[model samples]
Target: MTMDRKGLSPDQLKEMYRQLLYPRLIEEKMLILLRQGKISKWFSGIGQEAIAVGATLALDPDEWIMPLHRNLGVFTARNMPLSRLFMQWQGMQEGYSMGRERSFHFGSPEHHICGMISHLGPQLAVADGAALAYRLNETSRVVLAFSGEGGTSEGDFHEALNVAAVWDLPVIFLVENNGYALSTPVQEQFRCISIADKARGYGMEGITIDGNDLLTVYDTIKGVRDYCIRNQKPYLVECTTFRMRGHEEASGTKYVPDALFDLWAQKDPIAQYEQQLLKEQLLTEDEIASIRQTLKQQIEAELEAADSGSTLIIDTAAELDAVYAAPAITALPTVTDEMPATEKRFVEAIRDGLYQSLERDAQLVIMGQDIAEYGGAFKVTEGLVAVFGKERIRNTPICESAILGAALGLNLEGKKAIVEMQFADFVSVGFNQIVNNLAKIHYRWGQAANVVIRMPTGAGVGAGPFHSQSNEAWFVHTPGLKVVYPSTAVDAKGLLMAAIEDPNPVLFFEHKALYRSISEPVPDEPYVVEIGKARRVQEGTDIAIITYGMGVVWAEDYAAAHPEISVELLDLRSLQPLDHAAIRASVKRTGKVLVLHEDTLTGGIGAEIAAWISEHCFSMLDAPVLRCASLDTPIPFNTELEKNFLAKQRLEQSVEELLGY
Candidate 1:
């Protein structure tokens, strides 16, 4: 008689059993520690161990795997140092994130594992990006993204699935349907019969299987993995299992029915696999006891070794370097007020900056909505597709979150991506991927997201509330992000060059009002202006206008019109890692200073400048630092109302009030 082997030998089956046993024993050890007050918390993957072990083993070891909160078996299966994992749980200095992030909230690039963020769905999009890189490189490596059933409800999950299907990316989405999402059951999460059924909507092939059977997970994923690599297509596999433990140890499982527990108890993956090995004569009862004893002893020893490591404490000075991959841009030598002979608009200079970068770097790809043959909504990239083709200047779906996540994915393989937001307001939809994932990746995992997001921002041309609002303050408050806003065409080109060359994520804000309105003699040759440098538009002794973007326009015009005022205007090219020396020098030169910005008066960037001046430059100030800003209201669609709502309306008056004081 012949039996189905599923291409596995007895030794391989025994090895699979050993691999699957690690997470269960490790989880039991953690539970003992939790009760003893040695560990704070843990998300138990007790009953669903088969999906993690089997799915990880199905793919090649070098391929990428983005694990979910409950997939602790992936870590053990990857053979991560048990000592380091214990240290990570204890917030030791030798842990993966250097104690910056706790628990499974960190990634290990050496192991080709992308870490999980607390947010459920955005990481799925990030996994799609890694697959996109493999597709671009023409490598057969596939990426596995693990998600719980509840995570599929998020828009990001749908967007990621849609992109992978449309692009035919090499990815295997593993949905571990454990019947409960926190306290909410799978029934309340979606109307579909199974998570795999949702794949039909995205035009992808899918399967649903018995997750409690280790053989089913191994067999299904192994076959699906080959299909993904061979055809470069996405496949969804939903493994139906039960989470025997609560969401965490803190959240009790009282809501689950007693009968449900009794039903699932008979289907426990480790017990079923062990019994199968006995029935197949692969292992004896003595060998099973010996394996369990050996694993428990090993866990205790590793835990004790990790306990001996040094504890991690908050070191703000040491942590400062990890926040940004590159050093802050320094001030350059002052230049004369003479213009070069050549000329270009701010948009033209921006186009030149992008074109020059693309022309030089073969690995760079530009992704955005309507940015391909259309050259973007503003035609900033017009005629480029005719030169570089659509693959490099790619048009993307209207999914900001996915695009941002993909940009980070593209960065994983040393390739760079430049993302263009159609309007700055659209960034709200992509905010989590930017602030939570991209910005934090460098600090948490030492992974640099070498991407530039061109924010077509600010209100002036009556683009209304959705299209025209100054939202720079939102990023200014976020750590690990660089903010750039240039006023002149030359500065736009130079600053954009610096942003692209920087090793981390940069939010390049280009005011829509100044794009076509401002023109200057910009040099054809490529050059990089320092990001944190503040350029002096004019020098005077009486007062100084500290501003950026459109504020520079209003201040420069006001100063030019009133020559007798002896005004000095400063244009801050960068916001984060701001040029404090320039600000102090200007404050020291002039007795009075006024902070100006186009954003609303409350909670604007100007407020920070004013507060800093008051704290650091109070002795030099003849009067208090004053702020001139727009009223706290949305930018109006009406032309006249917009003018009334802008800071330019009260700029001259605010300057006069400061001068009089």
Candidate 2:
């Protein structure tokens, strides 16, 4: 009964021994269940148990940990109920994801665990996000981010590390160098002496440790945590361990050399730790046997409880309901028509709306490249930096994936974040973070990513291909996201505020063409235009044009000029939670319908709208449903080519054709 230099009492070491043994023993049981057809899959952390156990025990209660798939020790160390863990793996109704997700692809914010997606590299950036939140909220919460040697090869790994270092974020970039990622060996992964060596390039301290030595890992992490908190800086640690089992229960280790297995067997972490405790006389042989028996009985009981739980029920209404959190439209002020003393341009209205939002909510933070001092790419955030200061109006590196991931982290900490993409086209860089992480989090784990991604979108202003592209369709197709594309200054301001105030992630697309080109009366006072509601721009009895974003502008112009044709234009402000109610009402009024959009023809939102009209309002139609959209090609650089490629040039022809029909 003696203490170590790091103040580890004999009793504490005995408890650590128990915690370490739990996952190792349970993992063996899980593999048996997998073979017996009781479970679906198993990612064994048999030999690498010390990494998760040591790290979790070292962390404070408020600190967040982003663990990978094999880190069951982190959960067991937190003392999570064995029954609930069994239910989650079995996909029961009471599971963490309610049967929507499986394995470790789930998060528990209440437990200070940031869930990781399959894309391992993105979690590094998300760890930076929670660290950034800690900085903003002054929480002093350090974060431990886990990645494998193969994941370090991803671009997000570099971007996240560089940003965290430059910003001096309180995070420990822990790489569990488990020798192989799936089947790729460490030599093929990188040429660096070790993963920790790469940390020097980011101007951060780095270290490598024996992952199998339990006490060493526990003590090292405690010191790293202290260093991060003390200096508000990032640090990197590489734990050289071996994945004892195959990648999973199915993928046998035929590729692994027999000599390596012999090498790691002698260094088995659990076996080594058990001997250390026995030598110190912490627990006798009988006590160890009794502990094992108790764990076996408990696991069996938990497995039985999981099996006896009610089977998952498939409800169509419930399935649809779970896709996106119901929109918080009830908060919208019922004043859509109140006029202001003066008119503001689309960009000004957005700026005004954002200013109002920031003034209203202290927890709301806006991050983007050049957004703080230079006022964003389009100057939409101009002069607001002076008003709000750098903390709230923060400028970030050109790391879209990291920033978007970080925004989700901010949302986890009960803060609202607005990420301004310099151009809508650049959203491609962060697409996975948006679609997979942010979009799926709410549906998978019921934690809404309550963030606003401002897409300064559409093809206009001669910015050319990369800078000018209408890519709203990408997000429109994603279920857990709300897509808002406003055409007028009023809707831009109103929808901007609404998207900011939403309880779920919202992609608010502000068309660049309307930023300065259009001026309309807008209320100086703040108000929210309800999302999922379409605005009827003009009343017509002839042909109805259903459109969003720039398509609304062109349709309005055409309707104004052609006095002979009574054209009804429906401006769908929100695309995903599309105003089906309004679209149905408009098509019934004007049977001949035309769906128009600025995006490319084939997969644009126009097709979805056209299909819906055909299905529900076919009997009311006087003519076939026609679509006006850009050619199925990239937005060109030349003016004439761009114009020809737009739905605007084809608008008059499609309207005349539909009218004649």
Highest lDDT: give the candidate number: 1
> Whole-model lDDT for model 2 versus the true structure?
0.88
Write the residue-wise lDDT of candidate 2 on 105-206 in tens digits. Answer: 888877888878988889888888889889987876799999888899999999999989988899999899988889999898899889989999999999
Q: Candidates' TM-scores?
A: 0.97, 0.98
Worst 10 residues of 1 by lDDT: 330-339
Best by TM-score: 2
Model 2 poorest 10 in a row by lDDT: 332-341
Off by over 4 Å in 2: 1-5, 329-332, 339-341
Pairs clashing within candidate 1: none
lDDT of each: 0.89, 0.88
List candidate 1 segments past 4 Å from native: 1-3, 327-341
lDDT of 2 at 501: 83
